[model samples]
Target: MPATPAQPSFALPVPVATTVAPPDLTDSTLLDVDPDAQMSLGAVALDSRSDVVYATVELPDGARRELRLDALRPTGDERLPLVVFLPGGAFLRCNKAMALEARRHVAESGFVVASVEYRVTPDGATFHDSVRDVRAALAYLRSYADDFGIDAGAVALWGESAGGHVAALTGVTDGLPEFSDAAVLQGQVRAVIDAYGSSELSAIADDFDEAARLHYRHRATQFSAYLGRPGAPFPEIPDAVRAADPAAYATASVPPFLFLHGSEDMLVSPSQTQHVHQALRAAGADSTRYVLKGANHGDVGFLGHPGTGLPWTSAAAMGVITGFLHRRLDATER
Candidate 1:
C-alpha cells in the first residue's frame, strides 16, 4: 500500500476577521481583534486540499509570532520565490489576512507566500522591534528553506500601510542586521512591493489641528502613546519618525521596487509613495508606481477580498494584485 499522508499539526486556515462589529468609530480606531498566536514555524497545516507551513517563532524574550508559508511543491527539485509580508496599521495593528491575500496573488506567480504577525503595541516594544520581527521571520524561512521547498535567494518583501513602510525600509537599508544577520533572515531578497505606506509623520502632520486626522489608522495612536508630544506642535519625533520612515533611508543599494498608492487616501498622503518613487528613481533602482484613484488606505483589501465588487472592495483588490504579482514576478523569474 502507498504511504499514508501525514496529518497537519496546526489549526485550519482562518478567514480574515473583517472588522464588522462596528465598535468605536471614533477618531482613534480600535486595534483589530487579534488571532491566535501559535508558535509553530515550519510546521505544516493542511487546508482544503493544500498544505501550508507555518514558520512559527518566538523572540529571544519568548514573545510568540507566526509566519504562514504555502506548503507548495515544484515540478522538479527547483526552488520557488518567496515573500515575507508585514501588514500595516500605523504601528499598532495587522495580521495573517494581509499575508493570505499576498499568497492568493503570488502563489501562481511561482512564489511562496509568508504572512507575518508582529508583536502588538504597549508591550514596551518600539517601532524598531516590529521591523526586527520581519527580519527575523525572513531569516527563519531561509534557515529552513529545504523543509518547505522555498528558494531563500528569491524572497521578496511586501506590505501594506505600516507593513509597506517596513518593506520599503528593508529595501532601502542594506547590510543592516535585518539582512546581514545570517542567523535569521536571508541577507538578500530580489524584490519589494511597498503598497501605499508612508514613513514620514510630518506629511500627515500638516493639518495637525484637525481632530479628524487623529482618528485614522495610519497615525499610529499607540505610537503617540510613547511620543507624548502633540502632532500640531510637530514634536521631536520627526527625527524618530524620519528614522522610521523608509523613504528617508532610501539609497542606491535598495532592491527592485513597486509602489501602489491611492490618489484620495485620507490616511496617508499619496505623496508618501511619490517620495519613495522619486528616491528610487534617483537612485537608479528598478522601480514602478500605481496611483489608485479614490481608493482608501485599505485599498488592497478593497481589491482582493470577495464581495468588493461594487467599487473599491476586496474582490477588486484580488484582480489588481493578481496582475501586479504576475507581471513583476514573471520578469523576476526571467
Candidate 2:
C-alpha cells in the first residue's frame, strides 16, 4: 500500500516535430526551368534476379545438377535483347556473380544481361559439357523468353577467358549436331564478345612470351583438367583440344565476333585470340580484334577496373565493347 501511493505521478513527454517547413515562394524565379533544355532523364533502374535455373544435367554418377544464371534487366514491360555472360575460372568453377558491376553496366545500357553457370572441372565436366551447358542455357532462355522479358531472337554471347572460348566455339558451331542435343532448343547468336579467351588450347603455352611462359606454365594442368585428360602430355595436342578450339569451327556463317585481348596477358596469351581472329578472317567471317596495350590476363586492365598505366584503357575497352554490342544487338523497343 505504501509503495503504490506515488507510483502514478510520472507523466510521459509528448512527441515533437523536428522537421522545418519550407518558405513559401509562389512566384520565385528559382522555380522557373527551361522545358526544352538538355537534361538527363536519369539512368534506368535495373531489376536483378539471381539463381534462375536454366538447365539440369545428369552427371556420370547418376546424380542431377541444376545449372543457373543471374539476370539483370531494366524495370519495364518490354522485352529486351539478352546477353548471356559466361565467366572464367579456368574451367574449374563457374561463378555466375563474377564481374557483377560490369554486368550491371551492360544491363543499364538497354539490354538484359544473364551471367550463366556451367558445369566445371569439379563436376567432372569437360569442354563438351561446358559447351552443352551454354547451349542449354540459351535454349532455356529462348523457351522462357516471355517470362524473363527477353527477346528470344535477339541474343548475344559474352564470355571471358574460358567462357570466351566456349562462346566463340558455340557461336561458330551453331546448328551443328555434335555440339548440341535435341533436349535443348537452339538459337542463333547475333554477336560474340570474346574477352581474353583461349582459342587453341594446345598452342597457348607456345604463344606466351618469355615472361608469360614462366608465369603461366601451370596452364597446362588447367587445360588437361578442362579436357578431362589429367596428367596428359602437355606438349602433345589431343583431338579433344583440337575439337574444342573455336578456330577449328570458324566459318563464313559464324556470327560476327569482337575479340579483346591484353598485350600483357600471361595466362591465356593474346596469341590465343589472334589465332581465332585470323581463322575467322580467313573464313570470310566478320571479326575484329583489339590487343590492349599494357593490360594483363584478367587484370584490372582487361576488366576496365581502375589501375595503373593509361587509366583510360578501361573506359576505352568498355566503350569498344558496348559499341560492338550496340551494333550487333540493337536496343529492343521498351
Candidate 3:
C-alpha cells in the first residue's frame, strides 16, 4: 500500500535505509564494505516550515545516523518545551517518523519535540548499542537545543512498546552513564507517557500454558536477535533477557509516569503497566495508569478502531498524553 497520512495508523515513512557507495571506488574485487552501510530505512524527511528538518550525524563509529527536530532560535523570544521521542517496532523495525508526527501533534499544543533513531537488530546491532544511541540522541539534542527552538533542560520522554521501554528506562535512570549519559535527565523530566509497552517482564501474565510460554519465548528472540548470539545455547537466555530489562533501573529518582495500555493487549500484558505503576508508587514517583476497554495491543487510542479509519480522536488518549506534557513542561497553573 502507498504511504498514508500521519494519523490513526501512526505508520512512519520507512526510508530505503541503505548507504550509497561513493562514486569513486577502487577496482580491487569491488572493495569490502560494511553491511550496515547497506541497511534500508525508507525514511522520508519533511518540514512544514516549522522551525527545523531531519538530519543525520556521524556517530563516533563513523556511521551516518538520523535525528529529527526543529530549528532552535537563540533569542529568548521563543523557548518552547521539548520531548524526546522513541519509535516502536519491537526494537528492530520502526524509526523516527512515528515519534516525529506524534511530536508535531503535541507541538501544536506548544512544544518542540525530537525524534531519535537508535541502533536496532535489523542486521548488525546489539542491545547495548540501542541504549548507546538513545543516550547519544539525548546528548545530540541537548547540544543543538539552542538551534532547534528547544529548551535544553525541559525535555520529556515519549515512546511506544519497546520504545517506551527505553524511554521509561531513560526517564527513571538518568545520570547513569551505563544505560544513558543524559545528565540533564536527572531532574528534568517532570513526567513521561508510555504507550502499550513492557514495564516489567517478570510480571508477564501467568507463564504456565505452553502457548503462553512460547509466546514469551518468541518475544525473547527479538532481544536475542540483537543482544544474544543467534546460535547461542539455551542456557544463556535467562541472563541475556535480564540484562535488557528497563525495570532493573526503577528507583525513586525516576520521573513520574503515565502508562496507557489495552486490557487485551497480547504482546505485552496489562499487568506490565500495573507492575511499573506499583514500582513507581513505592518509589514515591507520581504515576497514572489508564486501561482502555475492549482494545488490543495495536493502538491503545480509544478511537474504537486501531487505525486511520476511526472517525474522531480519542479524547482520553489525547487528554492524558497532553495533560502529562503540560504538567511537566508547562507546570500546572494554580
Candidate 4:
C-alpha cells in the first residue's frame, strides 16, 4: 500500500448570518389592509450583461481587437430608450465599468444603459478610431435593439472627460460622411451629456492654472499619443488638433446637449465646457451648461454619492441628468 494516502482536511464553514427564530404561523390571522394606501417601493430589479463584444477592429499588422460594452436594463418586456455611456481614462484606456452605481441608477429610472469600450492609445488608435468604435457600438445596439429591449431611434450619448469629448464629436458629426463608415448603420442621437471634457485640444494647457499646468504637460503627451503622433509636441499638428475639437464641428442640426463641469477642475478647464456651450448656442442648437461649485476633476460630486458628505448628494446631480434625459427622450410619452 502506498503509505496510506494523506487524509484531506477541511475547514469548518462560517455562517453568513445569525440564525433567527421562524415566525409562528399557527396563531396568525388574516387582516384586511387598505390596498390604496400610499407606499414606498425600492429600485426596480435590474439585469446586467457584461463583456458584450460590440465590434472587432483589424489593425494594420493583421491583429484583431474586440471592442465590448456592458449593458444594464430593467427586467421587463417593455422596450426603453438607450443611453450609451463612455468612461474616461485620458484617451489612454477605456475603463467601461467606472461609475457603475450611477449607471445602475440611470437604468433604474427606465432606460437601457450601456457602457461602451473603445480602442485607446495602447492599441495605437487615433481619435478617429475611438469615434468609429463608438459609432460601431451604436450600430450594433440598433441591430440588436429587440434582443436588448432598447428603442434604437431614441438613443443618447453620455460620457466623462475624454469620453465626453468623443461623445460630443459623435453627436455633432452624426451624418458626416468623413466620420461615418458605409458599412456601419447610423441611428439618430437625441441627446448628449458631456462631463468635464475638453472641446478644444490645443487650448487645454492654456486653461489650466500655473500649478496645474505643470502636470498638464504629461496630459499633452497623452493627447499626442492619442493623435497617433507619439513623442510629438502637442498642438504642433494644428490640423489634427482642430479635427479633434468638437466645437469646430458644432452646428444647428446637432442634438440637444447637457454640459457638466467642475469649477474646481484642474485637469480639464471649465472653460472647455463653456466654449462648446457657447458655440452650440451660437449655432442655434439647444445646449445647457452646469458648473458644480467646489467640485474637482472626476469628483464624487458629479456622481452625487452621499458618502462624500457634500451638501449636494447623488439626488441633486442625477436629478438634473435624469430630468434632462426624460425630456429629451420623451420618456413620459413612451
Best by lDDT: 4
Q: For residues 54-170, what per-residue lDDT tens digits would candidate 1 score against the true structure?
A: 345455477765545333332345576776777765655554553443354345445566677665453444556666666766776777788656776677787887788778877
- Give the alpha carbon lDDT tens digit for every residue of 1-334 in model 4: 0111122132211111112122122222112222222122236899899999998888767899889999999999898999999988778778887767677778888899999998888788888888989999999999999999998878999998889999998998877777778887765689999987987766664555554444444444668777767776553677777788888888998999998765555566667877788889889999988765555555332233322212112455566788889988865644
Q: Summing lDDT over every window of 10 consecutive residues in candidate 2, give the lowest-scoring window.
A: 1-10
* TM-score (all chains, Cα) for each model: 0.66, 0.80, 0.70, 0.81
Clashing pairs in 2: none
lDDT computed for candidate 3: 0.56
- Which parts of model 1 have CA positions greater than 4 angstroms off? 1-78, 99-102, 177-182, 205-220, 225-234, 299-334
lDDT of each: 0.54, 0.71, 0.56, 0.73
Question: What is the TM-score (0 to 1) of candidate 1?
Answer: 0.66
Two-way lDDT contest, 2 vs 3, winner: 2
Backbone Cα, N, C clashes tallied per candidate: 19, 0, 20, 1
Q: Estimate, for each residue in 220-329, the C-alpha lDDT of model 2 and write its tens digit.
A: 46567677777564455468688888998888988899887765555666678878888998999999887665555553333333342231124456667777888888
lDDT of 3 by residue, 171-228 (tens): 7766766665445344556568787676544334331334554444444455456554
- Candidate 3 wrong stretches, greater than 4 Å: 1-77, 99-101, 181-188, 201-210, 218-220, 229-236, 300-313, 331-334
**lDDT comparison, 1 vs 4, better candidate:** 4
**Distance (Å) between predicted and true CA of 277, model 3?**
1.7
- Candidate 1 whole-model C-alpha lDDT, 0 to 1: 0.54
